[model samples]
Target: MTEPQTTHFDTVLVANRGEIACRIIRTLRERGIRSIAVYSDADRNARHVSLADAAVRLGGPAPADSYLNVRSVLDAAAKSGSQAIHPGYGFLSENQSFAQACADAGIVFIGPSVHALNMMGDKIRSKNHVAGYGVPTIPGINEPGLSNEQLIEAAGGVGYPMLIKPSAGGGGKGMHIVEREEDLAATLETARRVAQRAFGDDTLLIERLINTPRHIEVQVLADNHGAVIHLGERECSLQRRHQKVIEEAPSPLLDDATRARIGEAACAAARSVGYSGAGTVEFLVSDAAPGEFFFMEMNTRLQVEHPVTEMVTGIDLVDWQVRIAAGEALTVEQSGVHLTGHAVEARVYAENPERGFLPTTGTVLRLHEPSGAGIRVDSSLADGLEIASHYDPMLAKVIAWAPTRLEALTRLDRALGETVVLGVHTNTEYLRLLLQDEDVRAGHLDTGLIERRLPTLAFRGADDHLLAAAALFLHERALNASTTAEANAVWARPTGWRLGEARASRYCLGVSATDSVSVGVRGEPGGASVTVGDGSPVAAGLSAGHDGTMSVDYRGITRVYEVALHGAVLHIGADGFQMELRNRSRAEELAEHLLSRDRVPGAVSPDVRSPMPGTVIAVNAASGDAVEAGQTILVVEAMKMEHKLVAEAAGRVTVNVKTGDLVKLDQIVATITPVNTPDKGATE
Candidate 1:
């Protein structure tokens, strides 16, 4: 191999948004390189924009108009005078055309060559190419442009429980598993539609699904010089719905010999396409037979779980990607790459785990991230930042490093417990619960473990203590906000004071539309007696601390809570749990009570509310159409995931939302009136 020419870049552009963009900018700042950030309209006030030395607007909130627009990204690079463009993992990172456009525009693409991208970017072709290089690949039928009939016919040969994956994208997008022949046809159509919408390519492949598999991927680094090395592997078996939730470096399932063999196979796969920069080679190792492994696919860009690898190997992957793109040779060889302490990372998404992990949207009313020994947070969160459904749901990642795997897990759980993102529902508590599982602690993991353990995991809801804290905090705020004149007047005071016994001020807080808690408080907020529901009265007090946290002493137990009040809603966060309690007015409470009382016995609710805020992608039922229970009425798309709104009862449906309409969370999109109910035309 000939010596490659070297170059230096004074300014580099990050062609992405969110946490990954923020993470890339951090590395660039450390290396003294000016970073330019690009963002969509939805991310105009994003953390990445404030962190970069300079920023440029791409387009609208949609990915097609903004982040994924090749022309706009290249124009931003040219306008900003960027010498190189670093496509952070998601948007245009693995796009072959974007890489070619960078080359044509005389801007360095901080990734592998377009040839390598074309070979590995398509999973179907990559599988074939790796197999030709004598790499062990899973048994599958991977032919481009196979008709639906052809795929369905070939499924028998691949055997049962096969996977249908889109060729053009990584991540878990557009991937479906077929358990029986009856479900194959419908699943294929749905997969193709999703694949085309997401990756702009409907090409797909079939792979035999490995039962109880462990997802292990080797991180490989290659340079312009003929040097390539692997940085061990990561255990990514803890996944939900095919997306990884937890990841750790130096998999406990692999021995020294198996690790070395897998590492070599990853390097060979990279060399087959003359790969360069940082990339990952994924493999499926069955838990039943850990010694054998098969190639899955290769991610041609930095991965979301790359921080765990950096924590264990002490390597900055983004920094190396820049250096390699600037024509720098590989400085560290295979012999020097050593795995140090164990590192574990958990993703914190703006989602409700109890609600089937549905994506949620809210402003960050209060934010508190953990920082201590062996803890690292890669975040794009800030106070008052709006988390919209236009982008990925991931808010941040908390990583912990320790000398042992158990210590690492323990540290990660504690870090999550300290994490508090108020106003938005998150999976922090769920992550801690998963870490405490016996199977997870014993390292008896598989890809299906989280799914199997999900039902058994007990998720905590808002208890009496939390309700008391919220009530007391709100009462205290109201007391402090009273005018001086009002404070001195007995009639104007809000202490619920009376001549004989102090009248308890009753507060009805709404946890949800259908769920509520009644709290009664007597005396002042500083020293009050609180009663939640019909429970016994408890002596409680609320005090303001100097550090912006509120101290709530309930039933002799004092705890500090991160509290924020938006309008009438009170948000309290502590110990990785967050709850939003809305103060209901007397009239609202009375109306809700009447509504509940008016419900006839054995009658189903006619309301069909959207579970989340998103755009209606499809409307399956028309207005005034009769629909059966469990029938899909509409499909709502948010953050690239589609949710179907199903009818809860057999009735005549009234569809209020149409395709392309934006709906809010819990917004009634349709109504289903029972067949026997008379339609009151004047009072409808």
Candidate 2:
């Protein structure tokens, strides 16, 4: 029954980038606080930079040289005259040293105390601390002085199907699941190596892999004055590769009793560490046992999925975090905290889920965010923004909140359908499909749901409508490029005047050079007929708008495509599908082949190309060395994840790039020549 207290700060520096940075800036502006943003070389013109009151450049494009550099961040904070620094999640948000450094510099760190951070930063310590409060925890081991051999022995005792995890990392980095003992050593080594590179800590922890466990994490807010309260939990069971893809609040499976228990446990975890500000205490709930849950890990910062909890609670977590950081009391009591409705958030990422969820990089030629009654899109993207491979691939977070879970799910699907992003390939359509799954619709979810349904989630190739749209878009572009006089002259003549007959030209339109479809187009001006790969012709009416959008009408159905030309590539956005088209006429195709004489069939070198733009982290083989099929030849770090390139067949290797060298997309990093076989007939 107490009025809420408020604290005032004139300026704050955001020590991160992307959507989270933008989210914080919004709250700061709402509170009439000046916001400062720090950017890398790659983000000189980023949306976050433009939205801030002022921005300071850190260093290069790589995170270490920029966002993750503590001294540079502090320097920027000082230069901007910020009274507080909000370390957004991911980049030093949970770093205890960073908090201490802020204190040392007399700048308030908008997070928990260093003591709480130190306790929760290490998973083992946090688990042990919470267990002392009678909170159940997943069986795991992390010893300070254990050797690799001893760690392996300890893992055996924990039982098989164990998870090798990085003790100091999150976001699914440096985590591996081992099904048998034979693969433990290699998995452990790989996990440790990646962990060291990512978190600068190679410490490993072994834990039991709970089968079909639901990932539920409660949002807790505490103050320096010792008041703590839980804002309910978010259901993050939908995941891929241990990383959450979709998150929701008021888990359908959690009865009132179970929800209370988990919330109390989370508060206990927070109180045990003397937690302050916004923090999340994650727990793994058994699907079969319902009420049985165990502590997973605690994220001592605002989580990426915090919006769902905010949506249901009608509270601004960032505001609360700032208030708490300003030495204010937690005015809201546990009884005052209320959950209103259901909410869901699907992370829209710049990744091709169809291709093993590989991160994609390109210039964002166009971006269309969706908005409606129940939809909220938090993003920091703009047209012509270059999506680099240095940081996380998440482009935006689309959240839908409604009175019920089903309505929220339905609204999320619709919102996802309305999203449009060109140039960079995204997983919007993939998210929509996942939302439509029967199990997902019914709230039957688990941590392994996505992995189990990946086969069905793979791309099934573009449909007829997509091909027709591509062809029509190209045809319209060619017409638009012609001079007014030339276009008039062509229109005056017959439909196929060049061929001396009314005939359609069969143009080869393809998603790629190899994946193509033939479309027959015949028209004069303002009208055309398009037939897809031996299908019946559909009469179409086409017109161009001043904004480069093409309006097409076929069989009483009208569709508008936002088309843009970037050199030889045509970006098409229609019907929630973003496609890149490369059109080639028959004559042009022949000319291209005739002019290209470098490649010879059967004599072509089998070079292993970098799948995406990244830096070469390691080279496992040198020139003239032999390698077997499926052996890792090189390791590439892109979008903060390591991708190991393996040989496709037995061959002699030829490495092309040195470690730490930046490589371009499709750049050849190595080559493989098939092993020679004996000429048995000649020898005999």
Candidate 3:
């Protein structure tokens, strides 16, 4: 190991967005380097833009128009006089053309060399290349330029229960598992479509699906001086749909000898490609045989879970990336690299886990991130920030470090419990539930763990207490507004006072589109008796804090809740769970009841609304077309994921949205009039 020397770069542009961009900017500021931020129209007021020394607008909200536009990124770098461009993980980070363009323009790309990017960026080529270095790879067919027919022909040798993966992209995108030979062709077509759209390459690879597999990846750092070292391994076994949810360093499944062996193999793969800068080599290790590991792929950029590695190793990976790009040598030796303590990170995504993990969009009305000993938050969240559907659903990452793995998991769970995101629905509660799983706590992990436990995990819904608190908070707000408007008029104040027995002020609150609760409050908000639904009346009180948090005393239990009002809906967050309660008027409730009663018995609603706001990528059914129940109507794409809107009942369908049409959440995109039922005059 040699003494580290300072690297100089007056200005460097970060060619990415979100938490990764914010993370990189912080490192640049600490190093006294001017940071330039590039943003799309969707991220005009993003946190990273504000944190940087200067910013340049890229273009539209779409990735192709902004983040993925290599020409625009280069122009921004040149306009800002940036000597180097640090692509933070996604977009053009592992893009060989982008790296070559940077070199042609005399701007340093803060990532691996073009040759390394080309070799390792494609999973098929990398798998073949690594196997030449004596690295073990899964038994699969990775021949490049294989058509769907060719892949189907080769599926027999690969065997059933094989994985079809896109060679050009990482992060589990365009990856599918084929359980039967009959499903190979259609799955291959779908995988190729996704690959072409996501990575601009439709090249496919077939791999033998290792059952009970553990996703372990080793972080490696290399410099132009031919020095490469592994920073230990990260356990990313907890996943759903092949996407990582939680990650930890120094895998519990690996003994010291196995860790060393895997680390050496990772180094060998990097050396084979002449890799430089921060990168990750992913491996699929069998849970049954932990010592046997198979090469999955090599990500030619920093991974999203790098913080877990940094927390345990006490190394700044982004700092090293910049320094290595500046022609600095690796000062830390492999012998000196040590993993201390334990660290765990849970990604907080802007999604509704209960609703099949659909992407969610909202303005950040209230934000609260946890902070304590060994707790770290790498986030792109801010007060009033608008979380849109244009980018990835991940909003932030919450990481915790402790002396032991169990303690780290505990701290991470506690931190997630303390996390508050009011307006947007997030996976904070889901992350906590996953952290508390018995298998997770015991380190009995596998890539299939989250998917298996997902059905059993009980996600908290809007319970009675939460509903009571929300009703009381609304009552308090109404009372204050009335008092402020007409202080002298006692009748104007909603105090529930009457000539005889005090009348109860009734409120119809909609917890969901179909469910509404009737809450009656007698007396003032400070001291009131409330009854929700058919439950008994209970004593309740509400108090406001200067920090915008409200304390609700419901059923003799007082708890603090973060509250924010967006339009007609009230967003309340507590115990890492968030619920939106809409104050429904008497007329609205009556209309809904009437509509329900008028519907045909056992008939689903004719109007089909979009579950999420996104662009309609495909319309499977045409207007006036007869469709069966569960038939696909249209597909909506948001946050790079496609969700199919299907018919709820057999009926004559009328599609309202066309391909490329942007639809809002809950917007009626189609209608399915049940057969034999009288035509409802146009769907509301």
Compare the candidates by lDDT and give the number of the best one. Answer: 1
CA-lDDT, candidates in order: 0.92, 0.85, 0.90
Which scores higher on lDDT, 2 or 3? Answer: 3
lDDT of 2 by residue, 1-684 (tens): 454345579999999999999999999999899999999999999999999999999999888899989999999999999989999899889888899999999999999899999998887777878899988998878665555778888886788899888888887777899999999888878887888877888888889989789999999999988798999999999998889999999898899888899999999999998888999989998888888999988999999999999999999999998889887897899999889989999998888775577788889887788998988888978999999888999999999999999999999998888888888888887898899999999999999988888887645465676666667666665656666775658654334446466677666765653346788778843678888888998887767733357777777777787777676677777645676776766776675556445557545447787777788889898889999988999999889767898888789998999999988756778989898878878754
Off by over 4 Å in 3: 1-7, 484-488, 545-547, 600-602, 677-684
How high is each candidate's TM-score?
0.97, 0.92, 0.96
RMSD of each: 3.0, 3.3, 3.5
Minimal lDDT window, size 10, model 2: 490-499
- TM accuracy, model 2: 0.92
Local lDDT at 502 for model 3? 78
Q: How far is candidate 1 from the true structure (C-alpha RMSD, Å)?
A: 3.0
lDDT of 3 at 230: 99
- Winner by lDDT between candidate 2 and candidate 1: 1
Inter-residue clash pairs, candidate 1: none
Candidate whose TM-score is highest: 1
Please give, for residues 1-684, the per-residue lDDT of candidate 3 as tens digits.
Answer: 554454589999999999999999999999899999999999999999999999999999999999999999999999999999999987888888999999999999999889998898888889999999999999999899988888888888988799989888789988899998888888888888888887778999999999899999999998878899999999999999989999999899999999999999999999998888999999999999999999999998999999999999999999999899888898999999999999999999999888789998999999999998999999999999999999999999999999999999999999998999998999998999998999999999999888888889897777777888888878777766764545536566667776778777887888776778889888777788999889999998877832369888887788888999887798998889888888998899899889878887876778899988889999999998999999999999999889999999898998887999998878899998877865689575
Q: Candidate 1 on 261-313: residue-level lDDT in tens?
A: 99999999999999999999999999999999999999999999999999999
Better of 1 and 3 by lDDT: 1
